[model samples]
Every structure is written in structure tokens, then in C-alpha cells.
Target: MIHRLQNISELIEVSSRMGSDINLIQATGGNTSIKIDGYMIVKASGKHLANAFSENIFVETNPQDYYYNKNGDIKIINPKKSSIREGDLKPSIECNFHALLPKKIILHSHPIEIMAHTMLNSFHSKADLALKGMNWKYINYAKPGEALAMEIAKSMKVDNNIYILANHGLIVCADTVKEAERLQSNVINKLKLNRRVLKDCELESLENIVESIPDAYLPNNKIIHTLGSDEWSLELARKSAYSPDHAVFCGIYPLIIKDINQDWKRLMQGHTYAIIEGKGVILFENSGKYLEDMLLAQAEVFARIPVEESVTTLSINQCKDLVNWEAEKYRKKMLEKLVK
Candidate 1:
């Protein structure tokens, strides 16, 4: 048992180091865990990785012995302390999934480039293609917590070391923390290399239209002006474009509008801007600007990467798949809002 805890301590150090190195996780956006004996030392909920060195990572009840409630939430019972019960130091909202993974070391994160791809419905096949021959599984999207964990446990095959959480992030597991980190780094590097080419563009034509929109949305209008000319728009319309995932969330095709009024009308009709075409994306009150900001922020992250680094490009068919998925999600969200 003493040796096991020592091993777990080493695993935690490796996990924390990798999390810091990857740029995917900032503050507390990701978590890591190591299984020791019957217990697991998971990154404590809401703790930043930079501060997640040796002492502060919390020690909770053994995950193996945790019980499920009627609602499917795990009821963690800490045997060591009389006061420490199920609800103390709320387990990670994703704790159950981490608990169920068969690997001794587990790491999960929402890397901007990866998240941009995963959030789009079109990229599933692309990811499958990229990861072909690798030991992995892709799980459909599910709400976080016990339900997700249950699904992962059931869907994951014993031979797979990685699980791509649809619309979420990636999970890599291995016998050792170093192996898992290597796998993650390799995947990220491959994705970067695959997306290096810039889709052809000619931005001289949309100068007038770009002038009218609010400045808040046009952080880099000079680039937009250079890339979104009428001729550029027409040409881009004929060809598929590149973006890590904007094509998936907003749609594969740019909604070319000659005027702000037309742009408003299209948005009112429910359309999003494509990254390649520089058509501004629209957000509805029901869907909220938060989700829109997330998408744009993801795009900005990709934009910062050098053009030579992004090798993969989304196909036209993949773009259509994302449009259909986002449309369905929007419909469901609108329906729920109406109900409320």
C-alpha cells in the first residue's frame, strides 16, 4: 500500500506536468488521476494545474467502493474520516467516468484545436480516420457525470487506450503516466500537421460590408478586408474551407451577404458565419452568446497557430453533417426554452 501511494504520487507529478505543457488546459479546465490500491487520487475539483504540485491535490474516498444513488450519482463514502462523507469536496463532475476507466493513469483535457473539431458533428469521421489503427473509441455526446461514465464503461473496449468524448474532449489512458502523455502529444501534433493549409481566399471585395458591422465582432477587420472580397467570397463559395471546427459549429459554407441588413435577415433565419469565408457568425438569445464566444475563441486559438502547422481540412460532406447536427441541437434548445 505504501509503495502504491508512492507510485500514485509520481503519476500525479507527471500528469500535472503534462497538463501544464499541453496548453489545452488552463486554470482548472482539465483533470488527472492515478489508481492506487482501491483508491484514486484525482485532481481535486476546481484546483488549478499550476498549483497542483505534491501536497495540495486532495485525497478522496476510494472510487472502487463508491456507491450509486437512485439518480445515478456516485455516493462517495470516505471510510477514513467520520466527518468526510459522500458530498464532501464535491467530486469532479466527471469523476464517475474517470473512476470507470480501466487504466491506472488517466488524463483528460479540452484542447482548443481538438475541442473545435470534436464539437462539430462532421469531424467524427475525420477523427476516426486520423486515429485509424490506434487503440481508441469514440463515445457519443452525453451529459457529464454518472450517465456519461456509465456509457463510457459500457462502450469502451478493453484494448483501447484512448476515448474521444463526442462534443467534449479526449481521454488517454496507459499503464504509465508517461505513455499516456506521449500518446496525447502525438495525437495533438498529428492534428496540427494535418490542418496546415490555408483555404484559398481573396478579401478585397467585402470592404464596404465589413465597414458596417459593430467593432466588437471585428477584432481583426484589416485581415477580414484583405480576405473577404466579392471575388474572394465567390471563389471560396466554390471551394471547401479550413477551420479547426467553425465549419462544424456554424456550418461548412459561408452565408455571403452584400449588406448588413441581409446579414441580419440571414441570422434571423438562423445561420452562422463560416471561418474561411469571414462571414460573421450570429448567436440567438436562446442559445446565448456564451456558446458563440466559445466557438470564436476556439477559432482564434487556431488562427494563432502558423499556417504550416495545420494539415487537416474538413471535406464538404463533413461540413454538411455539422450543419445538420447544430440545427438539431438548436431546435432542441429552442424547444426546451419554450417549455421553460
Candidate 2:
């Protein structure tokens, strides 16, 4: 059994570095973990990786105490006994999956390059070709928590160290934290695709809309313009969100606005941002920096999707499942805290 105290320093260092890389993680979207003895120390729910070292965001728990139902619901054998730490901070909802894996260190991230491929309708075929040399495992869509963990458990093998969650993210594991990071880097290098150059468009129209909108409607009461002026971004905004990150953070799809006079709240439903024609994207008053990163990631993912292949987006039911998840709500709350 490894001593948690002995490894805390390295764990903190690795977590912070991984979290700070916007190319690999956005907001509190990804999770990291270290296992010693029967306990798993994981990034607490709602904790950002960039701050994983500075803050007390790790939770110690006995992952064996959790079980899953046929329907994917999680059942903790005993909450009080399961925890090895004192505080309200909760371990990542993915704690069970981390526990089930055989590796000593694990890192999960939502890299845009990886997402760009996973979002494709031909994910199985395309990924098969892209990740030719690696022993990678893929999970069909499973709601986070028991269902997702259960899916991973089924396919995880002793030899395979990389996993791709459909429309979700990537996972890399190794005996050491640095090795895990290396493996993650290698996976990204292998799957990386060239970004598309956006066609030019005029943004003078967006300036007018920004001036007309009340400060109350903008995030931080500041009007932030993004993506809409680029021709590629405009077409992407019109399409449906195909991945879990896009659906959960950006919404089922971006709200396209042609007129500033429309009821902002009514049209936005519960989405975080909107796309205006000939203008650009507009964020809501409550939108946080974490959200802004997600929006940018969406732009990158959309730009990276190859022009020849058509991508399939998540369906309405799939989108509903993600947006309504309680765990995701907590992450959103943490993101909101960051902007304040």
C-alpha cells in the first residue's frame, strides 16, 4: 500500500498542470485520481484541475463500497464509512470507474482534437483508423455515474491503458502519474487533426447588438463577442450539438439570434450562449470563465471537423439526459463560482 502523505506532493503537481491546459481540459470537465491500498483519492466533484493543487479538492473513498443497478443508478453501501476524509466535498462521480481500473494513476480529459473525432457519426470506423497502433477501448454513450462506470468496467482489460468515451472524452492510465500524462499526450498526438481556417466575415453588426442589449443580460454585465463573425462558426452555430460537453455546457444547440429585440431568456431556454447572424456569439450575464472556455472549445471542435465527412449530433433524448443530470449541475455551480 502506498502512503497518501508520501504521494500528495506529486499528485498535486500533476493535477494542477493537467488542469491548467485548456487544450486538454476546460473548467471542471475532467477528473484525475490516485489509488493506494483500498482507497481512491480523486478530484472532488466541481473542482477545477488547474486549482487542484492550491485547493483541498481531493476526496478519499473506498470505491468498493459502491454498486450499480441494472438501470445504471449508483448505490453506496454506506456513505459515512465510505469516506476517508471529513468535509462536504464529494469525490468525482466517476470515482467508481477509477477504482475499477487497474492503474495506479489515471487522467481523463475532454481534448478538442479527441472530441472532434468522437463527435463524428463514423466514430467507430474513424477512430479505428486514427488510433491504429494503440490498444484503445471505446464505450457507447452511457450516462455518467453507475451507467458510465458499468460500461467501462465491461471493456477494461489488463493490457489496454487508453479509453475513449463516445461523445465524451479520453482516458489514459499508467503506473505513474507522469507516465499517464505521457500516454495522454501520445494519444492526442496520434489523433490530432489540422484546424480549418475560418472564412472572413464582418462584425460591425455585432457591435450594434452589443450596445443595444442591457447590461443585465450580459455575463458579468460585460458583452463578450465570439465566433459568429467567422463563416465556419456561423455554420457550426446553426448545427445541433453532437457531444456531451456541447450539449451540457453550450446547450442542445446554439440559439441563433437575428434581432436583439427578441425575448432573450425566452429564446435562450436554459442555454449559456447565443449566436447572432452577421454579428457574433453573446454570453449571458451569469456566464462564467469556465463557460467561455467551453464556448471556445466548441468553436475549435467545430472548426476541426473535416469538411468531407458529415458528423452526427446527439439526439433530443440524449441531450435531455445530459442537461438534466444532477452531478453536472454541481459542476456548473462551481464554474459560476469561478467567475465571481
Candidate 3:
């Protein structure tokens, strides 16, 4: 275990750097892990990657013994079984996948570019052309945690090193930390696609509407801008959420304000932002950076979607499933805790 101890700093540094990139991970949406000997070190639950290196945000575990409880939920295996350090923080819900994979390092990210492709109905086939140089496994959307790990195990191939979780994100595994970083870079470079840029006029128009709303719902100091004034973005906002991340962070669908006469109180009850027809989007008071990032991500996903292809958005039922899941509830609670 001496070798593992020597590499702990590297693992923390890499994970912290990855978290610092808003394009790769926003808030506490991603996780990283390292396995050495009989122990596995994983990002603690609800902990931001940006804090990985600065704080004791990692938990060590014995991966060999894990199982489900009577309620069919996976127990938090060896949550307190640690040799490196101790804390009250919980391990990431994704620790199951990290433990299952035999690689020395595992990095999972909800990169907007990668998720943009995965959110589409044609990701499995389209990704082939986009990432032709590397072998990747595309797994359909599964509930996070054990369910996701099970699907990954079933889909794992002898040659593929990357796994793209549909409507979610990407996972890369490698025998060495340097190789893992290289693979992630390669995937990002290959998945590059053009996106629509909102012009100054479009942004000003949205700001005008936002300023007009005298209600407390719209914040005056915060930035006001449309994700995109393009047809694709507007259309995407009209549908149900495209992924669990969207469903949880944003809302099931954006509330479109066709007329200012609409009941503002009722509309903003559970939602954080609203889209105004022929104007733009307006967020609630003190919406903060996390909500803004999610809106931008939503816009990017829509912009990258092929005009001819019909995207596969989360169904109402599926959206409900995600919102009602205990894991998501805990994550949301933790996010709220962090914000405070």
C-alpha cells in the first residue's frame, strides 16, 4: 500500500483539476476514484471536485463485500472501513461502479459536449463516427448507483475503455492516471461540434424583459440572457427534460410565458426559470451560478442536436422517477446544504 499512498496526492490533484473545469463538472455532479491493493478511495458524496485536493473529501472502502438491503437498496458497503483517513462525509452514490471496475483509476464527468450527444436518440450510432479512433461502450440510461453499475458490467467489452452513459455523461478507466487523463482529453477533442452563439441584440432583448418584471421573482442585479434564440433551443425548452441532471437541477420543462398575464406565482412555484416568447429567459431571484450553468448546458445540448434527428427526451414518467428517487433527493438536499 506504500505505492498507493505515494499516489494519493496525484489522485487528489487530478480530481481537483477536473472539478475546477466548469465544462467538465459543475457543482457536485461528477466523481473520481482510485483503487490500491484491497482498498478503494472515492470522492465523498455531495463533495465538490474543486475541494478534492484541499479537503479530506475522499472515503476509503473495502469493495469485496457489498450487497443490497431488504428494501432492495444497495447498502453503503464499508462506508467506515478506511485506513487513510476518517470523516462524516458519505461516499459518492457512484462508488459501486468505481469498485466494480478493475482499473486503477476511474473518472466520471457530466461534460456538456459528451452529454449533448448522449441525450440524443442516435448516440450509439452517431458516436461511432464522432469517436472513430477509440472504442467506446454506450449504455442506455439507468438509475444511478447499483443499477448503473449493473448495466455497465453487462455492456463491458474486452476492448472498450470508455463508457458513455446515455442522457447522463461519460466514464473513462485506465491502468494509469496519465493514460486516463489522455483518454479524457482525446474524447473531448473528438466530440467537438459547432454551437450557436447568442448575439448582443438577443441578450439585450431578454434583459429588457427581465428588467420590466417589477416582481421579486426576477432579480435585477443578476445576469439575464437567453440560452439561445435559435429555433432548436426554443423547441427544446418546450419539451420534458432530456436527462436526470436537467430534471433535477433545472425542471421537467421550462415554463414558456406566452403572455405577461400568466400567473407568475403559480409558474415559479417549483421552477427556477422561465422562457418568455419573443423575449428570452428570466431566472428567479438569487438563482446563482449552478442554475445558470444548467441553463447554459441545456441550451448547448439543444444546439448540438442534429436538426433532422428526433432527440430522446426524458418521458414524464421517467422524469417523475428521477425526481422521486431517494438518491436524487439526497443529492438535492446536499446541494442545498452546500449553497447555504
Candidate 4:
């Protein structure tokens, strides 16, 4: 019993620390899990990894077929209770893969550096070279759910642990929390690329336009303005989404206001954010922190892919796949119910 408590405590510590790193996590965008006494304790759908302590953000799922630990493995007869708002918690949509994986500790994260490489047209070769010595594999982008889980299963080898989910994120697995964390750090350091340094925009310049539109406002996070600081990053931001969170949080494509002074309201119709071409980004008053974090993640990802590099953004169909998913709908509903 003491040993089980120790494992759960360690899992919470690692999940909280990883959840707090902006470069690794944003909002409730990532998920973490650990196999304990034959059961999978995974981050609940729409729950913040940072709230592992304050809230019951975990859901315990039993693998119908796969036994977590094979030899004299702990079977924890009565698993820990899993509930939220007097209802049974839902495991992450990505839980299928977690159940299939052999590792005890698993973290599905979206590190900026990994996304940078994913943006490149030739990401497979780059990942191959960067992660040569490590047991790693790069899988093409698949909608998060059973589809993605099946794809990973098709490519995963017995020794493979690091999964570079193209146009998605990274997943590292290990026997213990410490090893999983150490491996995650090593993958980031290995896959890190040189970013295109962007020039800064004078944020004060936007003060003149705030009063023009009733809904328009300058963003609180200064980093979001980087969206318009460079031609490539601005173009990337102007184009389609770089990843799922980008599409789900910020709209598939931000409204591009050629001139912030003109009647830009028509263009912003349903958009959450907008780029004033080369000037900077503007946001609606209700654009929450989750939206801001996703936009900032784009700024970070775009700057890392050199201006000359070829990139691929999600297609309209692909974007629809994510935003329309029932899982995402539930997440949005969950967000609305959380106390601000």
C-alpha cells in the first residue's frame, strides 16, 4: 500500500511540473498517464495536468486485454476512485494508445521544438537523423482517437518509446516518471532547431486602433504580436493551423486584416484572432488565456522553421476533423463549467 502511494505521488509531481512548462504544455492541451497495479491512471479529458493535486484530474481505466505488469505485477484489487462533479470522469481521448503502450509512465506533450520540425515538409528525414540513437519513430498526423491509436500500433516496435507525432506533438514512455521525464528532455534537446529570430513590434502602436472597433482589443500577452513581426511567421500564422490545439483553440485560420484602420469587422465575423498583415495581431476581448497560449505557440513554431523551409498546414478537412469531434465538444463544455 505504501509503495502504491509513492508511485501515485511521483506521478502527480511529474505531471504538474511538465504541465507548468509553457514550452511543453498550454492550457489543458496535454495529457499524462501512468500504469499502476494493472490499471491505467490517465489525465481526465479536458482536465488540466497542473491540477493533479488540487483537483481529481485522473481517471482510472482497466485494460480489457493488456495486463500492465506481467510478472507478479501489482493488481491493486480496489483501484482509486475516479469522479468529477458527481460524475464518472472520462479518460483522455488519446487513452487508447496509452492502453496499448507497454510503458508504465507516458506523457503526451506538445513541445514547441517538436512542432517546429513537424512543420517542415521533410520532417521524417530530419527526425530520423536527430533521433538516430534513440528508439524513436515519426508517424504521420492522424485524428486523435482510435485512428491515431491504430496508426501508432502499426508502427510501434517493442523497443520504440519516443513517438514524434507529425504536425501533432511528442510522446515519451518509460518505466518510471524520472526516466520518462529525462527521456522527454533529451528528445527536446536533440530535436531542437535554430529559429528565425523575429524583429519586435512596438505594441503601443496598437493603442490608437483599440477604440475603433467595439469588440477589438490589443492582446495582453506581448509575445502574440510576434505573429506579424516577420514575413514567414506572419505568413505561417496567416495560413492554416500548425497543429490540433492551434485549430481547436484559435480558429483554423485567423482573420487577416490588410489594414487595421479599415472596416475589418466584416473579416473578423467569427474569428477569435487576427493579424494586421505586417503590423501585429489583435484579439477580441473574450479571447481567453487558452486561445492566447495557442496563438503564442504558433509564433514559437513558425519562427523555428527557417523562411526557406517548405511547410504543410492542416487542410480544411483535417481542421474539420478536430473541431467537429464529439470529444472536443465535451472538452469545450467541460471548460465552460470550470470556475474561472
Question: Which residues of candidate 4, in runs, are more than 4 Å off?
Answer: 1-7, 65-88, 262-269
Candidate 3 lDDT for residue 103: 82
Question: Candidate 2 at 48: error in angstroms?
Answer: 0.4
Write down the TM-score of every candidate: 0.54, 0.86, 0.86, 0.89
Which of 1 and 2 is the better model by lDDT?
2
Residues 205-266 of candidate 4 have per-residue lDDT tens digits of: 76676667778888767767878867777877867788988888887877776766665566
Q: In the order shown, what is each candidate's alpha-carbon RMSD?
A: 9.8, 4.1, 4.4, 4.7
Query: What lDDT is reached at residue 242 by model 1?
Result: 44
Model 3 spans with C-alpha error above 4 angstroms: 1-7, 67-86, 197-201, 214-224, 286-289
Q: List candidate 2 stretches off by more than 4 Å.
A: 1-6, 67-85, 216-227, 264-271, 336-340
What's the true lDDT of residue 133 in model 1? 84
| C-alpha local distance difference test of each model | 0.53, 0.73, 0.73, 0.78
Comparison by lDDT, 1 against 4, better one: 4
Task: Highest TM-score: give the candidate number.
Answer: 4
Off by over 4 Å in 1: 1-7, 66-88, 193-297, 300-340
Error of 2 at 225 (Å): 6.1
Error of 2 at 12 (Å): 1.4
Clashes (backbone N, CA, C under 3 Å), per candidate, total 15, 3, 0, 0
